[model samples]
Target: MKQSSAKQYAFSDAEYEELRRIIEQSVGIALASGKRDLVYGRVSRRVRALGLSSFAEYLARLRKGDQAELEELVNAMTTNVTQFFRESHHFDYLRETFLPEMVQRHQRDRVIRIWSAGCSSGEEPYSIAVVMAEFLDAHPGWRAEIWATDVDGAILRQAEEGVYPMESLKDVSQERLRRFFLRGKGVNEGKVRVGKSLREIVQFQRVNLIQPWRIRQSFDAVFCRNVIIYFDRAHKKQVVEGFADHLAPKGHLFLGHSESLHGLTDRYQLIGKTIYRRRD
Candidate 1:
């Protein structure tokens, strides 16, 4: 399928600077001095939707707390690209280490709780479901639930549907692909859908990581992966600390390989590379 592009905005240096300041202040996403093109690309659809011709006018309206335009602006700027099993090693670690630890921790209750913060689509959470299901089959009498969330409402809606093109499974193993996915027929022949059983294991919700958040209880594991790299250092620190606070003692925190908690927070003890467990 062809990707869609938003309407382009014609922005000047001053306009770019204004946008950079506003976004950085509101969400802590710092657009560098030379990022005029990126600012234009990201904000153009808001410009077109509001019938504003200049970036200054649109930006001023946004500063006035125009909720409608601000929502669109957030949509444009938030990165939503994701697919199933994008980072396979994380799943491997979950299966080999984290799940085993969780199983032992929850032996009396036999319930494992995992939170996939900023789960772009349904892929990551569903992948977790697949892993948990396989693990449960071996253990007998263990259960797991995955809470997946994203800031974008549209993406959360798509995630709840649990449908995607079959090609999204390219990296997934054939056994998992066959076991968890239902091959679409008729008009949906080229696509696949996650079955209800797997979908039921994962609950999708819309959540803004930057805002105050409360979970039912501390999670056994939190997957706030790749999404944090987009935030500035301050936002990164705040989010990581929040995750650490919500993490159970000895719970695990997984980050993208390129991401590091070094100097950001010291609450988590480094385990394997890119994986950190909350210091008990």
Candidate 2:
């Protein structure tokens, strides 16, 4: 349906409140007031696809506790906007400062682990992989691994496939593009695929930030950029504290340009713009 026709979707105030509660309980996104139209727009297709007549009926079915429907609901509401080397300074810091220090510290172990939480359709992790690949080319002995994860299964699948429209690589340099991606031709024209070397270094998985994480490894850096903005203050603090728990001592946490840890936690210190280091 057209956005202007969103009012025809039959969403009521009561139904909207129930959905807000469901989304917060299931996905940790706190949709504030004035987002009623947005919520209706995102879920209206699902309601129609399921052959439901109204938002009330959809909520009724969702109340039956169907896990699949719950997941679909979360997926519908989740936002996955992302791009390569976004907030370029983060990648620059990774290459110029963080990686060099990590290389020296892990000289004996020769392993570096990074987590790109809420990695969206894969740009962030892929960008990290490209930077790491370049670093590895020079060092020749170090190994790096990136855990790229998101709560949306559909987006996670896309992230794993590692394909993108050619236009998305606009910010990527020509040299780096040639080095890290295979240009598509013929049937796959106007597309690009991450090279084997870059793809091999990153692993994508489905993860919900509000829940207990099963990961056993500590990371040298955690990139949770532009993610926590969807969460409320309490949930945001929970997620940030969780990131700290999974970070190795002095490990860096990169947030979106507008995000900060100030007044949220004492576990990290601001080391740069939107960058925090675990306090020793």
Off by over 4 Å in 1: 1-9
- Candidate 1 residues 1-280, lDDT tens each? 2222453545666666777776766556667666666667668767777787867789789879887666567667777877787778898988898888787778688889899998987788998898899888989888888999887777888899988998888988888878888998999998999988899899887777888886658888899888888888989999999998888889889998789998998899998878998987
* CA lDDT scores, all candidates in order: 0.82, 0.91
RMSD of 1: 4.4
Tens digits of lDDT, candidate 2, 151-222: 999998998899999999999999988888999999999999999998899999899999889989899999
Which residue pairs come into collision in candidate 1?
Answer: none
Global fold similarity of model 2 (TM-score):
0.96
